[model samples]
Target: MPKLIVVAGLLLALTACGKESTPTPPPASQTTQAGSGPVDVNVPVEMRPVLSVDPPAQTPAPAAPDVLTGKDGSTYRVGPSIGDFGRFENVGVEQVDGRWVLNIELPDDTAAIFATWTAENVGKQLAIVVDGELVSAPEIASAITGGALQIAGSFTQKEIRELERAITGK
Candidate 1:
């Protein structure tokens, strides 16, 4: 009797597996109402909802000071360039806006540097020197232009005069 009962259970399970799965459609009431004329079923499908992402706000970067080196190889701090100039080139110095500017031209695209004034370049300060002493290590604000640029900072009358003379070899 136990064997017969097991066989019956197996048969029932087999029969259930043989049956095909049929999806249940939504109720007729859920569908759109039938129209009197030939209803165009070719209506355009609605567009899917797009994800809206808000970009972070833009903030101005801090300005980087100019770097100067003195005759003794001592570094000094200076200010940013006041006017627009071209790319930097060669080792030379010039005066702009009454300040001494060192022109250290880098062989790279410096457009991004000119775009902002920030303090990010503080650590990688350029070494500016006059004669042989180090003047300052001002962070490069942008690339040099025409192999010349101006340095800005609080300078005493003697310091300015000395720097001008050292830079110009006058």
Candidate 2:
């Protein structure tokens, strides 16, 4: 019984020592810095100097009201207000009825707004602005009613995503 107790006590002491010897991680701010020479070990673990890195310089964002070239080589000017109708809540582009369409969600009060905008602007270029940039300007083909309208033009995948992002306000 005495030998067994001594062995158990020795095992417990070893386990406790293992648990206590675990190296503590430094604070969140400190990290291993890269250097050409060998790392110095004399410095205190907590006081070891790390690198001070400045964030990447922010480039000036491009100005708005810029003209963008569409896939069909047509130039489109960024419009001041692309979808200002109160009815059109979320406008998006999609394919419907065998043609690519610009879907606009409309409320009850702005039912006639889409028709009026399309009717007055058919054959005239209107800017499809996304993220404050003129993405594409496709001519209004015809006056459309209801909550959906089709915008037909030569559009690439990038242009489609840009237009979708802009229309969705994402």
Question: What TM-score would each prediction reach against the true structure?
Answer: 0.27, 0.40
- Report the number of clashing residue pairs per model: 37, 1
Please provide, for model 2 over 58-99, each residue's C-alpha lDDT reduced to its tens digit, 9 standing for 90 to 100: 443233344443333333334345344322444554443333
lDDT of each structure?
Answer: 0.27, 0.34
lDDT of 1 by residue, 1-170 (tens): 00000011011100110111221221112222221221111221111111111222253222323333323332334343322222233333334334333333322333233223222331133333333233333333233332222332334446545543443334
| Alpha-carbon runs more than 4 Å astray in model 1 | 1-123, 130-132
**Model 2 regions more than 4 Å off:** 1-102, 109-111, 151-162
RMSD to native for every prediction? 37.2, 31.7
